[model samples]
Target: MTDAGVIDDYVTGLRRVLRGPRGPKIDLVAEARDSLLDAAEALEHGGLDRAGAERAAVEGFGSIGEVAPDYQETLSVPAGRRPAALLFVSVPLTTLLWSLIWRVFPTGPAAHAAWPGWFVPVARGLDILQMLVGVIGGVALLVLGRGLRRIRRPGTG
Candidate 1:
């Protein structure tokens, strides 16, 4: 099919998806149209064949809904925050629960509880640190994703 024809088909598919009421429906048709137009312009100047240009356009634009499921799972706009939040909540909670259990359990009546009791605090602190690191890493990922999106935006060099 012609490049224009292929682009139209892609747009139609995206529109059909968006028209549905399930999940995070987005205006993928508009996004594909813009991407195709940009790619078509480049191909026109670069002397690429219709098929080649269309393929490039579609591939470069990527699948609109490909990242949607991840986003939903993470409860993140771009899909990185969910894991971060999960880690942030889980680590501390798990550490505290484990610490309490460990501290309460006795290895032996003669065993000194004071020295061993410190281990629980140390483990809990490590858990908190792990959570902090995860949060920072997640934020960095989210920020990088945003930067990439900006770079891909129309009119950007």
Candidate 2:
């Protein structure tokens, strides 16, 4: 793996992963490339074997997962269920809203009566299922949010 081509391949892979959504916020793509190249140059300058230095360089870069948290703060991810709450609130509300709008502003009364005859039972069933899912998911998120808050509380440790 002392070959420049081998080193470049490793660097390219690292770059792609580092640029991915879950990757480190630090400029890891450039950093990995530069670090590998520097390692190669250092190996040559010190008269050390290329193969050993290449191995060392790869090892020193560390696993990508291990590198994520180091830069997580830069991403400013919120510490709770803000996203979850937003989703839970929006979904059922949107469904119910659309249902009401369709009922109240039907193009015609005959259409409205026909709609309930054909679709009310189905819609009611869906509403029940939606309620069950929303309750379960919301409760889970609430519990998780509370746990996170407790863990972050001062003097809790």
Candidate 3:
């Protein structure tokens, strides 16, 4: 059976208010729609017309203000995870790739000739700094990854 305007309006409001990872947001709204449709179908089978069943379904589902926050909160989890996961995988890969590139292909005169006095030490220092930063970043990622599990929800003491 076709949905009534009330169901459409409710779903639209739900979609409008939610914010987070797109995939999970879509899945949550789709699930909510399916549930409401199911409820409306049952109500229709019990003899209510389409409009009446849909109105009842929307009322039973709850208001957008009440429901949307929970959905947005759920979305925040995967949103938070993605950047952490990216950093965990990326930092090492970046360090290794840069090292390989430096070894395989040298740029200009720098590769063939020894650097003059101050330049040599400065270059070596920069290389050391790069490596040090990568190591520190990796350690930080590990600590943060573990700490992410202990994070409090949106609002609480």
Candidate 4:
């Protein structure tokens, strides 16, 4: 059987103060619980009763106030990276790919003379749409990052 209250209380309090993405928070909380339980078991093996060992284990864990900033820093890293994927890498790389393709086989006077009537307008429309979507998506991500920052607890990001 598990030693209940002391460990439960410590984990609950730790969960309360931590602010981050859901997946990381769950992993960190579960990790903390496992470590506490293992330490408690080791203490009990040294002749302390389960309750006494659990209480002591909790005490050994620093106060939530003292540890939360560290946890917040861990959470912030992934939060910061989410935008860089699209904004820094995918967007620029995709734009460069398209530019190179057009440069190698550009639609100039000779190419346009051979092209069907429908191709020009269709290609032009798609170009406009691509630019519009890129601008809209970039703005949305920036706004979303700002919104996430606003909602997060101070110093949590």
Candidate 5:
């Protein structure tokens, strides 16, 4: 195959392996294309025929399978301490706010007497829903924190 054909095949395989935005993928492909062409031109200048130069360029660059994973890792978001810290602070604050609300508006005769008959049930239901949402958020925060820790660990991906 021609140099262009080889580059196209390699880039197609690369695009399939890479994840995320189109812009980054296109940029990476363009970079690879430039490098491959440069390598091929260098080899040709060194007295190799066109076909031989192209082949040598592709071989030296390595196959898509061998290089894609490394590129993907580079593209991945790095785990940071900030997100875990934010979650840790927000989760407890949320729980505290909900607890205060629950305490301030005790579900008792005084509450029912002060508000309409429907108000108590509605308020209780809303409180329960908010609690459930808070719990889910806490769990999500925990999971995110754990994942961040794993990503931050040495010699891990």
Candidate 6:
């Protein structure tokens, strides 16, 4: 293949592996193209012809499968944050839902006493479940968000 064809294929393979906004992807492609051309120019200076220089550049850079994962890791958001953000959003929403349910059903002492036996048990069960969810979600949000923050902090991994 021609020099341009080889570079195009490399960029195309990279684009296939990367997952993000178009702006980042385009930037990555441009950077990769520039790097490949630079490497090719270096090889040409070392006495290889244009086609040989391009081929050597691509080979030295490694195949798309080999290099794309490193780029993907750098470009993509860390997976842990997704669950943390979800928990942050969900905890309050769940609490609000339970609050709305209680408001609609009136789950106070008098209401509980007047309600059917099955109703009290079911309501109590739901309350327990809601509390558990809220506690677990809150803890997860704290832990995950804290961990992410630490990872992002300056001079730290």
- In candidate 1, what are the lDDT values of residues 46-67, reduced to their tens digit? 9988777877777777664663
Q: TM-scores of the models, in the given order?
A: 0.34, 0.39, 0.61, 0.59, 0.53, 0.53
lDDT of 5 by residue, 1-157 (tens): 3537776677777777776456666787789888988898899899998777877888999877677766655544332234456556766766686677667666776775665566557667657766775776666566455643444321223
| Alpha-carbon local distance difference test for all models | 0.59, 0.57, 0.73, 0.74, 0.67, 0.70
Q: Highest lDDT: which candidate? A: 4
- Each prediction's total of clashing residue pairs, residues at least 3 apart in sequence or on different chains, is 0, 0, 0, 0, 0, 0
TM-score, structure 6 vs. true: 0.53
Tens digit of per-residue lDDT, candidate 3, span 18-135: 7678899899989999999999999999999989999999999887877776776677677767766766676676678667656665668765475345655655765776676678
CA lDDT, candidate 2, residue 102: 72
Q: Give the TM-score of candidate 3.
A: 0.61
Candidate ranking (TM-score, best to worst):
3, 4, 5, 6, 2, 1
Instruction: Compose the digit string of candidate 2's lDDT tens values, residues 67-92.
Output: 43343332323323455666668677
- Find the 10 residues in a row with the least total lDDT in model 1: 67-76
Candidate 6, which segments miss by more than 4 Å at Cα? 1-3, 18-27, 45-47, 75-83, 99-106, 112-157
Query: Alpha carbon lDDT of residue 123, candidate 3?
Result: 54
Q: State which candidate, 2 or 6, has the greater TM-score.
A: 6
lDDT of 6 by residue, 9-106 (tens): 77777787676556766787789988998998899899998878888999999877777766655554544456557767766776786687677678
Error of 5 at 17 (Å): 2.1
Every model's Cα RMSD, please? Answer: 11.2, 8.6, 6.3, 5.5, 6.9, 7.1
Deviation in Å, model 2, residue 100 alpha carbon = 3.6
How far residue 114's Cα lies from its native spot in candidate 5, in Å, is 6.5
| Cα deviation of 137, candidate 1, in Å | 34
TM-score, cand. 5: 0.53
